[model samples]
Target: MRQTWRWFGPADLASIDDVVQAGAEGIVTALHHIPNGTVWSPKEIAKRQQLVRVRKDGSPSGIEWDVIESLPVSEDIKKQKGAWRELIANYKESLRNVAAAGLEMVCYNFMPVLDWTRTDLRWGLPNGGSCMRFDINDFAAFEIHILKRPGALEAFTPAVVEEAARRFAALDDAGQKQLARNVTMGLPGSTESMTLEDVRAHLAEYGNISADRLRQHFIDFLSEIVPVAEEVGVRLGCHPDDPPFPLLGLPRIMSTASDYQAILDAVDSPANGMTLCSGSLGARPDNDLPAMMRQFGPKVHFLHLRNVKRDSDAISGSFFEAEHLGGDTDMVALIAAILTEEARRKREGRADWEIPMRPDHGQDILDDLTRRAQPGYPTIGRLKGLAELRGIMTALGHREFGLQ
Candidate 1:
């Protein structure tokens, strides 16, 4: 696998020096300055790539912009309502521009309500720094108590609702505000943020769309755009729902293996594939990460590697970001499977077959505190993750080659 880091462009607090130091040879970024629903000109893509290339510290030896983490999907496109034709047209144009810059894969998501939910952004770890995580009880409190969105309690069981009420009542005003901000505010790559009023307005946009309706809209949007992606040699890898469930009175369709299958079957093209985020899908016990790797191996063009410790108590459980080798996901076996696929591609003389993988969400630790980096994207944590994964890969590769 070719290791890459997700950089939020030049203005990001984590500089190109930080990415190179973390040992990533490739950069996963986007033209975030370009507004949603607007076309990205080739000039803009080249300019951004140049900035990263020049700012990198290692004699121009590190970090080339190779993949776009996203091209924001317009709400009009998501709703699949009026003006969708124009939105789809703009998306296709953007894909062509990205491809013209020689980028191969574009990672995107079609989740309706939220991109990824975290009850706590700086959820503390015993090891020192923090990691991003979602807690059902904390989220429940946000839905049923804080936001007080009607019918929000219906998504949870009776027991969960009662617990949520208790949790809500227990929190001080400041704590409740933090919970609301944590749930509703958009993080990086989410494209939009919401105030309490903005959230209600956003919910109104999805008034009649159920899960099925949302799924159909995604399918339709992909049907129009994937063909263009194929023409431009850009693989469109859709990221999974973060918690793998619905939240905030919105419908979530791409949260399971079957959901992935439905997407590939709907588009039925190599251009339409999965990003295979372990942290996102691994939050749910039912998602067998290894089995998913085997099943989707042929179609996976991108990867997000991070592990979570699921708690037995369910409601009270908090996910601590574990070391790449320490988590419940069995990442060693997962990486071995991916390498096996890469070996098969090599034997067949296929170029560009090694999937581009990245250590998904990292802990905010050490020197990263002095920098303005995004939470969970701290330099030291991901550098540690990449080092661990690299060591595992090296041992496996040497053993396969009979090297002592």
Candidate 2:
């Protein structure tokens, strides 16, 4: 795998120098300032390409843009509502522009409303470093009391609902407001943000959209864009749902391996692929990360190599981001699968044999506590993750576990 880093443009707390200092070979970013549904013109794309490849002193950064973390898909496109046609047109044009700029690996998600939900952005760890967490009771509290979505309490189990009520009761106004912000405030790198009212309205619109309906919509979306991607040599990878389960009463279409397989089969094009996000899918213990990697490695266009510690062995439960190797997903086994796949591709002389992987997220430690870097993406934390992952790759590379 080619080591890469995710960099939010200009406004990111971490600078290009930070990425270079961390020893990333490539960059994963997007034209975030451009609004969703608008075509990313060639000029705009060129500007970003220049930004990634150049430094303030006009010297080479030695890292070029390797992947587009996301090209935001609009809600209209997801629901196939008014102006969706124009939105798809814009998307196809954007895809063409990106490919024209020599960026072939692109990642996006079909998750509705929120990009990725978490009840706590900075939950403290025993080591004093903080990481993001998805606490089930706190989320249920948000749904039942904060957003007050209709039929929201019915979604959780009885025990969860009771605990959620207790949790909600304990909150003062400030606590309640903070929870609301954590859950609904647009996360970093997300396409859109929402107010409680905005969320309620969006949920109402999706009230009738079932999982099957949403799945079909996603297929419909890929049906339209996949061909354009194929034509432009762009490989589109759909990111799986974070936490890998339903939330806010919204249907989750891409949470499991079967879910991904169905979408891949429906689209049936090499351009149609997945962003294998270990942390997101690992939140559900049943995901079987290594097995899934072996099964879908050929179609994985990009990689987000992070891990999570699920609270239970059940299918859907609370989980917190874990250290890259310390998490439940068996990092060694997963990366071995990736290397085996890469070796196979290399033997076949495939162009895209090596996947671009970034240390997706990390715990806030050391100076990270004071830097207050972007939530989940701190300089030192990610550098630590990258170093750990590199060590794994190097050790595995030196040993023989059936690599050609």
Q: Model 1 over residues 220-302: C-alpha lDDT tens digits? A: 99989999998989888999987777777787777789999998998998888989998878777778888898898878889
Candidate 2 global TM-score:
0.98
**Candidate 1 versus the native: TM-score?**
0.93
Candidate 1 runs further than 4 Å off: 56-62, 189-191, 313-318, 369-372, 401-404
Q: lDDT tens digits, residues 137-187, model 2?
A: 999999998888889878999998999999999999999999988887564
lDDT of 2 at 82: 83
- What TM-score against the true fold does each predicted structure earn? 0.93, 0.98
Enumerate residue pairs that collide in model 2: none
